[model samples]
Target: MSENTADVTETATEGQQQPIELPADHPLVKTLAAQKESIKELKVRAARADELEDAQKTESEKTADRIAKAESEAASVPSKVADALRTHLVALHGIEAEDAELFLTANDPELLQKQVDRLVGQSGKRKKSNFVPREGNTSTAGASDERSFVRDFFSGN
Candidate 1:
């Protein structure tokens, strides 16, 4: 027997012994074939959609990485500027460099300058008292007869 004929005959005998026949032009068979073709097309489209989605996701991740890097760089800029201004403050003021942090309260350049100037002006005022004592007061109590209260007090007499 032909392979196709044997397959149909065997399947029919194993079942109800009734032949399964349908005209190719039957509405139900046409509809089933159309559905199968639609399923194949849908599977192809689904695979293409997955590929497109993966490409889009990859692009989005790269964009996100760039944005994160840019944000980090932007954040560090203010910190670097503040450190530079603090170093300037420390050099100009001749005070501890750590004290410069207090003056970093403002981000505005004009305001920072104003605060630095104010600190410098205030520190400059203190310089007057740092001058050396009079030469007469330089001697010790028992060494010189200068005998002034200021001299005695400075010499620890």
Candidate 2:
């Protein structure tokens, strides 16, 4: 009975000596406790914003890549079409082989035709409406009178 009482007294003394430490006065502990909730909320919002930015960046890159590929394909089409157009134009222009080769190598057909037409018109071969002489400027009576004079001069009686 005395041993049990002594053990009980010792346990009670230990419990009394080991006071429960309440976190009421530590500034760092208080700050950390207060910041924990806000930090978790901030982290969640930041993660969401980062995810949205990543998704937007990925979409933009895909669109850019698609546009670049389309442009490359489009560029190739014009070269091939231009080559076919050159062949057809070379035949239609009736140009000498060497000159046609030079023209096809150097210029587009429609552009060459425009240049040729411009130069040809400028070469004075084209008829001008204002420069053409009038046909019936002299009267028929004047011509007849001139003819009688010529007949009299030629046939002396």
Clash count for each candidate, listed in order shown: 0, 0
TM-score of 1: 0.36
143 in model 1: Cα distance from truth in Å? 45
lDDT of 2 by residue, 1-157 (tens): 4665576678688776543333566665688788998999999999999898768787778789799999999778756766677666556655456755654452454665565455445544655566547675765555677788887899994
lDDT of each: 0.75, 0.67
lDDT of 1 by residue, 90-116 (tens): 687786555566655666556777778
Best by lDDT: 1
Off by over 4 Å in 2: 1-66, 106-113, 116-141, 144-146, 152-157
Query: How does model 2 fare in lDDT?
Result: 0.67
TM-score of each: 0.36, 0.35
